[model samples]
Target: MSTLTTANPAYKLELTSSPHIHSRWSTKQAMWMVVYALIPAVIAAIVFFGFYQLIIISMSVCVCVLTESAIKYFRGREISIMDGSGIITGLLLGLILPPNFSLFGTALGSVVAIALGKEIFGGLGFNIFNPALVGRAFLQATYPVPMTTWSEPSYAVDSVSSATPLSAMKFDAVFAGKTEMLLGNIGGSLGETSSLAILIGGIFLIAIQVVNWRIPVAMTLSVIVFGGIFWLIDPAVYPDPIFHILSGGFLMGALFMATDWVTSPLNSKGMWIYGTAISLVIVIIRLFGGLPEGVMYAILFMNGFVPLINKYSVPRIFGEAK
Candidate 1:
């Protein structure tokens, strides 16, 4: 017979690594800060795509948060829907999607992002891939035709073509001006169209140290080197390096998705390698492969190598001998 004792649980000490200084910041703070940074791009999306875009964005966000919460509930774990990471992931996934993408597909992608991409790996810090990109990859595989379909922005006239700049280059042998691409008067994904908006937001994040600057810089440099080489080889056969850098999802991938804290490599050297490798893959895929745009695939491919890069590029211990 066991006696029932009304005793409270004993307190236990938790042990961890060094550098115990606790900052005022937290995961929620960082996530929300990123959300704030992405606001300009969201605004740009609405301006260019119209109100329906907001509906898609809202649907994605709600579904993502709900899916995360449901998974936690089923597993009997603490709910983390309020943390803002899901919102950011959903927003990013939606931003990269075409404005006219089916809402059901968008919601399904959000669920996959939260369930398989994040929760299956035990949530935020432990995930191997960027959740947004994971959702996008799934969507691209399942709905290739819809994913590739392009629509004109609201500011364009009825005569304007519905093809994205990259698509125009790939199929129609035409190129949009730098001015249209930069200002986002051209057709593309919701958030990726406006270089000006993405730059404003991305620069803000880098300025505040929310995002590492080395990744974007290295990627941009590699694009310049490889793309310039191709352009110089035959200007008539290839678009200019400047055009490659500005068009498609390159800026959005470099600034936001590729720099994801959970997926990107740690330390400056590893980040440089990661960024450069991703850029090279993008250039190769766009220039030599069947795809017109390759940012999504390139980032996902490099994400698999982050662990190896981190292993090799670990920073030297302070005061350690050669």
Candidate 2:
């Protein structure tokens, strides 16, 4: 029999998956890191929307925490609210909502996010779609009027209530200037208001390796290329590529939502494919479809194919003879 260890043994062969050297990281660590990275976007939302926006965020978070805690208590599992996943879901959901959304509605969305999007699907790692987005989609379906009724950004309060850039482009051929969209001075969802802030958060996440950079880069480039083609062909109707990239939830969706580890693909190749497909779907819906924006739908639709993407993209065994 061959000996597996030496006399001075400081190492051992552990049978596991590809990542044999397990780091000291845990789900809690990754979850909290993501929460910390979102601070910049949260601050920007508050600044743009005011103290009232804070209340909406607080309510959503509180309700989400409570909902998850209750589920765990009933399921005989240790309550893991401190894990930060539920908090991230709540914050993301709240950030995507209109700032003036009613408190009760926001709370309801939080409950759905935790219960349906997460717990019903066997909780965090098992969920197939991004939980926050699932909740947002439910809200959109149930409350279309409220979901579409956006409030103006703080800087433009003196101006009349306005449609979002995508909506304007779709309905009136009106183009929102790039500067306001970059600085987040125009009307949209709480988080989508500021491209600058979302970029800051995205950079932090990428720097810390909290998210894979490939998905965002791929998605962004696809949108630019696709949108640019349409714009060059018919500038009279289609807005420029920069507008599509900066407006609405494109940055937030590409960076934070679409990159959810549980929902997105596993391999680099699959990630590029997923990102490119998502961007194409978004442009198709925004340009030709009835809806003005499509990030949420695009992400959720692609999420369904993640399993197939992973299956086909798996690496072949090394040094194997066929």
Candidate 3:
């Protein structure tokens, strides 16, 4: 009888780690997309403020890119300024600044944003706070007068007060109409005046899946629910919920800064908690605190708790023991 020969397998199994599926977008793509999303705000800033605002924006971006490049060179790491993180930080800082802020101060803020806010903590992905906010906070402490000064937009009419909406409400008890704020006719930071422009960019980001929708939704809801309560208690004393949503930097901060992938929470549950806490703090500070605006402080404060939020909020692996 003829013996049958044993057959060898056609393919061999190879073991691999998790993350079997990969995203099509790279770090550079994500960073640049953020820059793209902010472009509408940048253009709106220039349109509302003036061409001088472009100079400020340019100065901030150049300084941020240069600072990051210098640090990378000194550390013997390959310079990756083109990766777009520096551009984003600078762009954001520029957007939030006073229209005609001194170039020197703008440069200093950009330096601080990249150095202390970013590279000191090991660069882009590792920074604890939003880099732009860090720089803004520094400038706020160092140059209080310049940072607080507001200017009338180029197209502003005599009826449109130069005082920022929040400032007007807080100090003068003057309510800037909802129509003016929505159309960006109110005096405010370069990029924060227009709810319309911010909404366009924010919605684009959310639609592209670049941003988590939960944080913004949670933050907006928190503001409406809490702000509404105060308004109902005394409409004369407290501004309405829509005013809270459209005025100041609430939309910009909720959509752009607080949703930062690095500083924000990871899981869905954690995002809701983080967003709610931020909005609550914002409400407290805006209504009762000495400051007219509290978005920067609110976002930075919540950034500190992201690690803890992630730790407890991670979902259990499927089919694993409790």
Assess every candidate by TM-score: 0.92, 0.91, 0.92
Where is model 2 poorest over a 10-residue stretch in terms of lDDT?
1-10
The candidate with the higher lDDT, 1 or 3, is 3
Residue 116 of model 3 has an lDDT of 94
Best by lDDT: 3
lDDT by residue (tens digit), candidate 2, 175-247:
8888888988777898887899999988888887778899999998999999999999999999888888898
Each candidate: what lDDT? 0.87, 0.86, 0.89
Greater lDDT among 1 and 2 belongs to 1
lDDT of 1: 0.87
Instruction: For model 3, state the Cα shift of residue 13 in Å.
Output: 18
What is the C-alpha lDDT profile of model 3 across 91-193, one tens digit per residue? 9999999879999999999999999999999877779999999999999999999999999988766447789989888998888889889978778999999
* Candidate 1: tens digits of C-alpha lDDT, residues 1-322: 0111112236244353432434345556767878998898899899988989989888999999999889988988777766788999999999999878999999989999999899999876778999999998999999999988887898666424789998888887798889888988888999999999999999988887778899999999999999999999988878898998899999999999999877998778999999999999998998888989999999999999999998999778999998
